[model samples]
Target: MKQLIKNLCYPLIAVLLFSACGEEDKSISAPEIVGAKLVSFGFYVEDNEGVLDKDYVVDGPIVGSDIEMKIPSKIDKSSLIARFTTSEDNPAVTVKGTVQVSQQTANDFSIPVDFVLTNNSQNNRKYTVRIKRPIEWVKKVRFSEFQLSDAILKVNPVDDVPYVMGITNASNSENRKTVLLKYENETWSMVGDTISNGRPSDIDFTFNSTGTPYVVYTDYTNTIPQTATVQYYDGSSWVVIGRNYNDVRVSYNSICFDAMGKLYVFSMNNAAGGVVGRRLMNISTYNGGSWTTNQTMPGRNYNTYNMRSILKKDILYLGVYDYANDKGTISVYINQNGVWTTLAQGMRMDGATEINYNDLDMDVDNQGNIYIMGLERFDSGYKLVNHKYTASTSSWSIFATPIDLIGNTKYFSIGLNPDGGLSTVYNNLTTNSNSSFVTIDKESQTWTSPFIFPDILNTKADMAFASDGTGYIIYIDASKHLAIWEYIEDNE
Candidate 1:
């Protein structure tokens, strides 16, 4: 009996030894990350039907300390989701913040992500991922023409063709005629016949979705009482838009088209007196059928001067200069849903007591942000001020002046850029020179160094941008010829 008990005890002792050896082998050790990779990255893009899922993968396996990604230009990069893989299973991967990638306000940006691996041990390995975008601007094409006045250039939003409108000297007669030139095959050619019925005073144009061009211009025909008639080019011939009233004078005739191909014309009228006064602003709309008569806007008092308007999405914004209270004032109005509501009225200069508001120009961005540029006479000198209206907050704030002393500026023109910013050009009367073409950086709320044209003495400068963020500038050169500077991207 004693021998049998010893044998059972020996077997039990052997089993206990095997269990101890297994526990020692299962002891935890430090985890290692031999490799890390971004599997698939994408976001949910909103579409007309619904949300569409867009997925993008890395070019290669993420093997080193850095990973690079390229985002398309002008893309709305907000709310991104990423899938990743690590050397070990179920590794922890996290982006730095609530990752929302957006290039709307900025030209480029960089984002960082982190990955950690662990295997029941205190020591762990981390890997960093970097994403970036690179962009640069290059000068592309320069085109020139001689003996052109009042030169205006516009790009077809559909086909990216450029159209130039100006007044040229008649070949035989001394009278000047209106000419429309289009850029094709790397050369400029006349679109139609040279309009010679009346002298072209002011002109404006817009394009339809299918790249059709429409233009409106004031024809100051040599007649008794001097009736200035408003005419429009209906893709063929110039036809009168409104009736030729007696002694009717139209100035600053601005025309724009909305998203629905509806045309709107804003101009200041003076009848009977045969004088051009910056007051008495009138709006005319063409509802894809026929042109309407002068629809008087609401705040047309005797003291109103320098009225300008711009249309965006179905909203009409009017900026008016009012001197009713002996001091110059600037007011902004909006016409939405057939109701003319005053968004801002009687806005006088905040710093100086006596202010002379000289010129007023208005523009709206794709995001519905409003910008009004005003040239005011202060105690020091002529100052240019920009008032920006934030649509989200429904408020206005004064932007920092790019140039304190405008030096008797004239021919002020402002337009929204393709990258959701603003570009302004003007002629300096005091210096007898043209100011540098200046642009507002929307993301930084700052002005870029004035871009000087190659020909310094250019006049009547106008600026426009294509849908792909390309910029074009047209002006009458020192030789009285039309010239254009194209801003292109250097992708290479």
Candidate 2:
């Protein structure tokens, strides 16, 4: 850390030397009066046409004439504009004796530069400014004990707190109960009663209009035509939805609430009402009294494996891994109005069956375009790519993916950023010697440096965002304890 000192000149020439430390030099002295003091300073990144790119303003008090600016180390500081304010109003600031204008003068700051602040073209103060990339404002990301033995995590967009739904005590199956926990004040506490007796194959939650949480899951114990159930806590006991909707046995359930607060559960075999075969997929909705079932896309024997969905306004998108034509391929179905259509039968090159497939993840942006992070066989090994579906063109194209993510990583998930940006996220827990959750923001088109988990065990991780842009990442660690990161800022 370098510091600048406020030099009080006693000679006409003001030959004062500033050290890397905060010490002022009395050697080779030649000034007699005090020069203008720089009150504030900032380094900015701008385009060639003077459009502001990024501004690195000094965060703390500027001591004397030493200004220490802190910015992210990843940002390039080679060509940058300097902006500063002087104690004297509208004083001319210069670097290396060339006349400089604040916010207009560009300089190469790969090394420390000297700025001379002149009060009236006569009295000037030489200020040495140094920049540092400080990663200390926020705490270091270290995994701590999270109480949920097994869990699915979510963050409320309104409250910005992490809400988890999973098995409370997995080691003791007799006493284990599916529950929801809210993380607040550095503690995990139960929000509602025990949801179920044991862990289900797929477990997730959604919020109703009144902000009440409603969870949906498949019954893992009943493999003899399993049952899909939805429940919510009503201040006391757990209230089950569609319990009387007849034999609604299904598995791999994912849920969400529409703007009308209607609960829509996407699963196979028409779990909400109709008892179809395991090949048919349906979207069941709860309408106050009874739950109704509607086939999402009819006549297609959709593979129910890894079934997931996302509904925004009128557009509803569903994705599943299809094993048709004796080859596993990624399949997508879309519902715009009342009509459901197939976007792609098999998302392979010309629907070829020679490709081996892994799991798939899909999300919808604000503009209703769908994105799929589908992993398939590419070249000699499996490759995962982000495919974007354009509604206007009715076509799917590959987006820029700088890294081989899904196939190479242990666990990879794609989700929409609910903080109101149309951006999507690519989060993966890498299989490195020391695993890290590498979160790639789609809009940035660059890789985000991940926080390393030194002894991470569980690759399962979930991320949620609050309204204030705070992100909470929760996962079970190698110690079978719930772990979390407040994630105030990007590591780089």
Can you write out model 2's per-residue Cα lDDT over 138-163, one digit (the tens) per residue? 22232243345656667664566778
TM-scores of the candidates are: 0.65, 0.65
lDDT of 1 by residue, 99-170 (tens): 322211121223455544443443355555444333333333334544766777777768877788787744
How far residue 193's Cα lies from its native spot in candidate 1, in Å, is 2.0
Best by lDDT: 2
Weakest 10 consecutive residues of candidate 1 by summed lDDT: 100-109
Model 2 CA lDDT for position 287: 70
How many residue pairs in model 2 have overlapping backbones? Answer: 9
The TM-score between candidate 1 and the true structure equals 0.65
Could you give me the TM-score of model 2 versus the true structure?
A: 0.65
Q: What do the candidate models score in CA lDDT, each in turn?
A: 0.61, 0.61
